[model samples]
Target: MYQFNFNFEEFLAEYWQKKPTIIKGGFKNFVDPISPDELAGLAMEDEVDSRYIAQHDDEWDVKHGPLTFDDVPEDHWSFIVQAANHWHEGAAQLITPFRQLPNWLMDDLMISYSTPGGGVGPHIDQYDVFITQGSGKRHWRVGPKREDYEEEFRHPALRQIKSFEPIIDDVLEPGDILYIPPGFPHDGYAIETSMSFSVGFRSPKKQELLSSFADHVIANEIGDVHYHNPDLPARQCSGAILDAERQGLENMLRSLLDHPQLMKDWMGEHLSNNRHELDLIAAEPQWENSEVREFLTQPEVLKRLNGLRAFYYPETPTVAYIHGERFTLPSECEQVIPLLCDHEEVTGEMLGEMIEHPAVIDFLTQLINQGYWYPAE
Candidate 1:
């Protein structure tokens, strides 16, 4: 377990999305869980998403990876690997401490290793991120939220912005954490070889929501009602749509909200969908009831797959959404739903009482067989 030194409620009320702040020694005596070599190793895998960025004076270069060491130069370069938690167990463990936030909004863990003077140029992110220093030191400069700025594309794959006046500038050491809210421009350059882990939270854009909702409506064949105006009032111009006509159109779009369950279902499914490719392997020789029961008797650890999204809506209390699929839980297992959704790892002893319920056993078996959840070792 990681020991968090900051005040949770105070931080949420004061700084969450309001501004950027650095918490020194957030995890006291923090030891890095994953090494730089291991991070580089994962970046070489074809399924993993990785990027190599190098700076040569004013000219910047970026390359997508499944890259070997020979492809990356030793100096003036940085290697970034996305969804590290999905493929590395140590990186997945970092997500446990951030459960204070909503589980649905929690994104995957991204790890980056940088050589001296290596950094992604100044840029703005649309989501909240808590970046923790894993090893060595990094100098971070963060500017306030601003919409007016010049964006530069030195490399097609990299989008950077003109330098801005920084409100917070400091060097972060291992165990230190820096929280930057959405729209804040920031940059971090390593002073030496170092590793950093980022735990990010998702914030859906209005346009993205509109597109997704439109797709859902179209796929379900919803909103079939056509325009019906029984009492036609004469208009000065045929081209001009009157207030009544505009209101009717608006209401037609709003009709999708008339079914609360439909909205909840769509939101649940959308939010529970994985943002990155996952590393998964189906269980071999699926366990039978007896085998499952016997397995549950021993002390074993069950872990959720990295990058797997799982959430439950309060409106539909009995249903839990995992990887865009909904599972109905029995009343007996309803109490354990939070345990399943929030934690990355759960021990057999923790679930010992619930194992007797057939519904719970079946759900666990299905999850294991489908490769969503499995024994840690």
Candidate 2:
């Protein structure tokens, strides 16, 4: 387990989304979870989203992978693997410490391996990120959010700012963390061969939420009530959409959103949908509820699949959402929600007598058979 030396609460109150700051010795004596060679091998896989970025003579080049690393020059090149946590168990563990933040806002862990002098250039990102320095040293330059900052595309695939006068500039060694919020201009370059693990967070735009909610309303056949005003007042101007009539029309849509249960249903389903692939392997012989109950009584452990998004709203505790599907669990299985979503590993000691509940047993069996979780070997 990685030990964090700083206070997360203090960091959130002071720096989160407010400014960019460097937390030195964030992970004391931090050891990298994945190595460069292993990262390279993952980049060769077609399903993984990987990229190669290099700069030479002030010109930039970008390539989408499945890449053979042979053509990559010895220096001035970086290999970036997106959603590495989905594929690598070690990478998945990096997100455990950041659970202080809501998992709904949490994005995947992006691991980058850079050669000497390698970087993606100075640019601004729309999401917040906590970048942890891994094996070697990287020099980072971060500027405060600015309205006048101009972004230019260095390569056809890469859009970067012309430059920024960095307020926070330092050479980050292993175990150091740089926290940057959205729209801040920043850049980093490797001083030596290095790896950086970035824990990113994203918030959906208003447009996206409206669009998703609209889709949910349409799918469920919600708000079928049409406008029929029984007491119609005579309006001189027919072309004018009366304020009262407009308010009524607006209330039609608002009514659907006003219901706590309906909104919760939509929130649970939309938020639990995984944006990245999960590492799932179904059981060879699907186990029955009896078998799962028996296994839970043993001294073994079951682990949640990497990158699977599972969530439950506190208001509706009995309803658990996993990968866009809703499960209305029995109140007897209430304890199972945290076990299923909060924990990466569920041990017999943790489950205790709760596993014996028929509802809980059946739920676990369903999860195991579907490959959302499995016995730890």
Candidate 3:
């Protein structure tokens, strides 16, 4: 287990989304959960999203992967694999300590391995990330938050920024963590063969939200009411939209919020949707209800599939959303909803409680059959 030492409330109040800071020895005696060779193996898989970046002098090159070990050079290159938690259990466990934040804000565990002098160029990210040094050492430089900066694209796949003055620069050893908020310019170069894990948090952009909400509205046949003004005064300027007309348009758009249930349901599904492909395999000859009950009765543990997004809304506490699907929790199972949302592993005792509730048992059986949760021996 990783040991963390920072005060959660203090960190959130003082530093989160405001600035960049380092927590030295955040995980004491931290042993890397995955090795460089293991990471390389993952990059070789076609379904995984990986990238190889190399820099020579001032010129940089990038190669999208499903790349084998032979394709990667010995040095001056970095291999990045996205959604490592989807494929690696150890990587998924890394998110346990970060549950202090809302589960809906969590993204994925991205792991990168770099050779000496290898680094992705300085760039700004729109989401918060906590980078934990896994093995070996990396030198990180983080600049202040800025919205205005010239972006440089040396290679087709790489988008970086020109040099900027750094406010935080230091060498990070294994177990060190660097928390960088959105809009900060930052860069990291491996001093040696090193592995680092980044746990990211999502912040949906306005345009993205608008686009998604529009799609939802159209798909659900919502907001179909046509505009009608019964008390219309004769307009002098027909082409120009009057203040009342503009306010009417605004009210028409804002009408979506009037249906709080629809909005809540849409937000729950949208937020719980996974951004990356999941590593899930449907159960072969799907388990029967009896078999599921038998397994639940045993001491075997139940583990949630990695990269599966699950959340419950405060407005409708009994309704849980998972991967764009909604499940109504029975009164008996409501108490355990947090366990299903926040935990990776559910113990036998928890399962025991859940199994007693027939609705919960049925739900678990359905999830297990669909491959969202599996029995862990």
lDDT for each of the candidates? 0.86, 0.89, 0.86
Per-residue error for 284 in candidate 2, Å, reads 2.3
Identify the candidate with maximal TM-score.
2
Compose the digit string of candidate 3's lDDT tens values, residues 1-377: 66577787898999999999999988888888888778889998999999888998888988787976676567888989999989988777788889889878888889999999999989899899999998999999999877788999787777799999999999999899999999999999999999999999988888978888889899999989998899889867889989988999899988887888898888888898988989888888888777777787887888889889988865455688899888887765665667787688786587556676767777877888888988885
Clashing pairs in 1: none
Per-residue alpha-carbon lDDT of candidate 2 for residues 1-377, written as tens digits (9 for 90 to 100):
77689999999999999999999999999999998889999999988899999999789988898878877788999989999999998888888999889888988999999999999999899999999999999999999788888878779888788888899999999999999999999999999999999999998889988999999999999887899889789978989998889998898878887898888889889999887777777877999999998888899999988888899977667789998999977776677787778878898789788877888888888999999998988
In model 3, the clashing pairs are: none
Candidate 2 similarity to native, TM-score: 0.95
Indicate the residue-level lDDT of 182 in model 2: 97
Would you list the rank order by lDDT, best first? Answer: 2, 1, 3
Ranking 2 against 3 by lDDT, winner: 2
Residue 11 lDDT in candidate 3: 87
Which one wins by TM-score: 1 or 2? Answer: 2
Who is ahead in TM-score, 2 or 3? Answer: 2
